[model samples]
Target: MRYACRPVGLLSRSDPISRFDVADVQRFYPRGRPPQPATFDWSFTMNLLGVLPYWQLGPWELGPLTLHSFGLSVAIGVALALSILGSRGQKILGVSGDRMQNFGMWLLIFGWCFSHVFEVVAYQPHIILEDPLVLFKVWGSISSVGGLIGGVIAFLIWRVRNPYEDHIGWSNVAAFTLPIAFFFGRIGCALVHDHPGADATNFVVWEWIRSIFGDSLPEVWPLALQYPDGVPRHDLGFYEAIIFFFLTLFVLYKGRKPQRRGYYLWTLPLLYAPFRFLFDFLRVTPGEAGLHGDTRYLMLTPAQWVAIGMFILGLFLWSKLRNEPLETWKGLEKSTSDDEEPESSSE
Candidate 1:
């Protein structure tokens, strides 16, 4: 959902952002003296305004296995996406459920592997230089944009292997379902407060909201998370979760009717890339020892670069597919039946 790497021996041993604890604030500073209070006291206005309390859900142990809430949420998201893909493939693309499931599994494997690789290679090249083996550790770190790139690669590979498949139709299916997965994946990020952003205390819109509450509003925005120094910063993950939730609804509504083959494949990227590029601006910059922030190059994060590419790709697809015919469920089913019918026996 966001870029994060566990502490290697060479890197800062401070806990991962997801694992940040209020107690750790004291230790984060010199001589056990935090610059400000490590906790906040919410007022009635904050509660009424739906400001979330600072909370962290740690991993749970089951026998020898550890279950993290983020991982569990991702698992659920993937499962839901696969289910939708399987069902929709048959009805909308004339692709079988089994085939869709196989495709989804491949996408999942490749998406996960690439997510780790992108994180290690693009965001933290230093990690790879330190230990070459870190590249093989697929569970180490991940980027959401990396997963998207992986999904595209996986689609290309699948198309090559199954050349007769309806590539455009399948792409539409994937584009429609991906937001559902992302919605939950981002929720996991929000739960952990991993994607921290710049200070929102004086953000104009938040300031306006605060003004509405008069003196009853707390100094910190209800949606903001306090850093070790007690500065309230926007939680980018939380904001994204809310955005994706609405996006999922929008796409679902669109999917209810027949549309062009590449409608979603192009439109989704066009809609999402610009917002994502803007959101990264709010992401915290690299902090002490490169902890608690995203890596940037040329004044832009890796995801911003990827977003630019996505926008370009979306434009290309839109230009090419704009003239294509719309595809309906019944039409796809009839075409599939016609293709499956055996040729008449020769005399």
Candidate 2:
């Protein structure tokens, strides 16, 4: 979607464009009742079809409550995913409406919590152990791998109680819902300017986004690339948004077939790992706080190693599904005669 420049936090939180914009930045910060200041400087403007052009759109107020844009994007992702799964993707999700609703709720809760835990554990596990308050920090960031683990945990817990459902497996609904969340979550990341790329002035956000879909961008579109510091670098969030968006589209197409739903578990990792493993080379992150693979050996992120694991897991899972037939498992594919017999859908 289009981002309106409503500030999320203080200028100190995100690099201020210039000293002149400090007053303007303060005015837009999510907190405080500062006096009105002069108009914002040119450095903060984004020329998206002559738009309101601010980088954020705010802590929207609903009576006494306030909702941040990042939270809004994530909420939108979950809501849209549930809505789609409930109305359009029941077959793909392989659950009835009620169960889909339940699964979705658990997935969101566990997945969201785990997403945070994954990053915190990766970057700062000591903080979690030293201070228990870290668990309550809802505003903290999410990790993709952590979210994946959490959601799977949730699915398994749900499955243990409701074991009769054929679609209740490690790969089914989790695979279907994840990319959609990832695509939308990346939008949140881009809106917040959290995922920065390496020192590269050549790739503008919109231009690089265009290039992801096979459009050829110029050698250097001067003035086209701009960040909070007014120095252009790679926009990893935007890059991921495009890639995951296409992935969402692909999964949508693939989800129509019942058998294809099973493949998404392995397929998604295959698509994500290698490309992102290489992609990390262009993106910088704190290597020291992470695992050995990420910290040592010239700064490869933990995500890269996770990608390698995912690649291997995908291969194993693919081979298993290939060599094994579900027909051997009782009641996997029910016959027409069985439909006539009265039974719970889960059964």
Candidate 3:
């Protein structure tokens, strides 16, 4: 069976400048020099044996509100991540639920707001130049890398205000739980098929995947989507979801054992950045025929530059904290109390 789908609500064609169609520039390009439209097939055939299933889920209407799948997934991911963070903070670091909730709230607010800012400033500065008011439209667009930077800023601000808290331990907890949010967020991207890539019909990895799945491998791998021209192309979001699925499992398993205070915090970026940097190469470029790609700076996508920075940050963390002692729940609790003692005495 085959299904053809088109986005509605936030990602609908009604908004020529919607987040998913950043490459569609027919409306904004210079006169007489409009770029080729990057169109893709919204229809795909179901293959029981395919390794990945293709589907596009749009938004739903609830009275006056239109609920987007991507937004809902992000909300669920945030809720789940915060729940885990709160439970872990209380049990491991002797932190109160209220404190943890406050931290999470700030992190979410800053991270979400800046994601849109970065989307415009880094990925599409022209949007802001065209209309400065677009900067205030936090729901207009977002960049995952921007969210990470915003989270870091939130952490820094929180650390300054709560000097008595076990900030390092909290960082560890965040490193362990943040991937859960990332995995689900990427799933939302996959469902929307927003991050289209270049043609992948001849990608060699599929041969190995085919060998392993045997008859289970679909004629068209779910990782690839059929373009309007009938050629299969990689879907970057689908690939990222697959990567994060394994990453989440690995971190959760490792978190079971006591680790250094900055172990996962430093190491995850080291492990993930290279892959992200490489993946950006597979993305379709602006001038690519039949497909619109991401905006690039000096030939590198914004995410690619962010990946490089992440790698450098990871290396710096490793150099600074590699020698730190293993951290345990009891140890962290005691450390937190020790930190609080000075403030208590002064008060």
Candidate 4:
């Protein structure tokens, strides 16, 4: 929870020299302190339904453990997703929770690698190509799209191994659980001030959200270039968190009795692609050019291009797999009860 050095007491004119503190020392001097920079600023926060909307609790300290927001969010999200997948997966897929969780673990690892690798290749190709070894760096952060692609590949490989598993049913289970991870991941980004919003000074939507929260959220100072209340950036991370929260609710609702079961795989991408594509307009991704997060490709970002492709894939997959029977993992067709009498020998 502790940030950097504590704020130095108000400098007294009577004893300016002796009263000189870290703040005073850093005022004229460059680079601040030697080890830890004196960069602690009071951040305003508000809690809603036990969750902090904008609380910047730097790092959690629990006894001997010290956990950062990104790491903690990842841990919590993975746990929640796996828990739901394990329990709900059994009901839908007839696979034990333990096995489902193990499969999910594989998906996560592969997905994370793909996501990070893709992010670098798309955003910072020069850096990636220059040093291909960077891919092995465990500490390096990853992106979501690439991660999910890798995860899906892992899942498909698992499916090949487990021939008894139902494709549509497993897809539904995955669709239902993924948003939970994304919800927490976005919240982590917001808390850590990772991906900031694009310049909304002239182009914007915070007014709608701002109108609702009003005084609860702090107002940003122009040119602040920071979190909590820095430069009124669009708060894109929080917006994404909101999107995933709603998506989670929708997926859970559909999972109850999916009419077109397998289409969950299709539907999820359809839903997410547009949201991501549109939201990119409000983001500021760092790259060789600058903070041009909106469009990564010739004019569109890699995500936007992927979004367009996903939309097409969704349309194709939905038509092809819509008729898959519900609970295909259990059986594609219902079996006759042993108690029921069979037809007579004579037709």
Tens-digit per-residue lDDT, 1-347, candidate 3: 11111332112233344443443343445555544433442223235334344567878999999998988887888888888888777767777766776778788899889999998898778777789999899978888999999999989998998898778888787777788989999989987877888877666677677767564445555567775556688889888988888889988888777888889889899988998998999899876865657888899999999999999999999999999998778746677899999999999
- Tell me how candidate 2 scores on lDDT: 0.63
C-alpha TM-score for every candidate: 0.77, 0.66, 0.75, 0.69
Worst 10 residues of 4 by lDDT: 42-51
lDDT (Cα, tens digit) per residue for candidate 2, span 1-347: 11223353212223345555555546665455543323344333322222112265677899999987777898899888887656433443334656666667888888889878777777566678798788768568677777777877887787788777665243455577778988898888777766665545444554575466333333343322255554555566777887899999997887555553356777888898787787667565554223122232346666776778888988977776654433222222334337756666556
Q: After the best TM-score superposition of candidate 3, give how far the Cα of residue 245 lies from its true spot, in angstroms.
A: 1.1
Q: What TM-score would candidate 1 get against the native?
A: 0.77
Q: Rank the candidates by lDDT, best first.
A: 1, 3, 4, 2
For residue 49, model 4's alpha carbon misses the true position, in angstroms, by 19
Q: After superposition, how far is residue 149 of candidate 1 from its true place, in Å?
A: 0.8
Candidate 4 residue-wise lDDT at 109:
85
Q: What clash count does candidate 2 reach? A: 5
Q: In model 3, where is the ten-residue run with the lowest total lDDT?
A: 1-10
User: For candidate 4, lDDT tens digit of each residue in 1-347?
Assistant: 22233333222232323334555456645673432334423233332211133457569788999889888887899999999989877766667889888877888888887888887777767777788888777468677777777877888888898888666677667777899999999888877766767544443244455467564543332222333443445666777888999998987787666356776788888888889889776677555124435336786777777788888888888888777665444421223332233554333
Return the top candidate by lDDT.
Answer: 1
Off by over 4 Å in 2: 1-54, 61-63, 92-94, 126-132, 136-139, 167-170, 202-217, 221-225, 287-298, 323-347
Error of 3 at 314 (Å): 0.9
Better of 1 and 2 by TM-score: 1
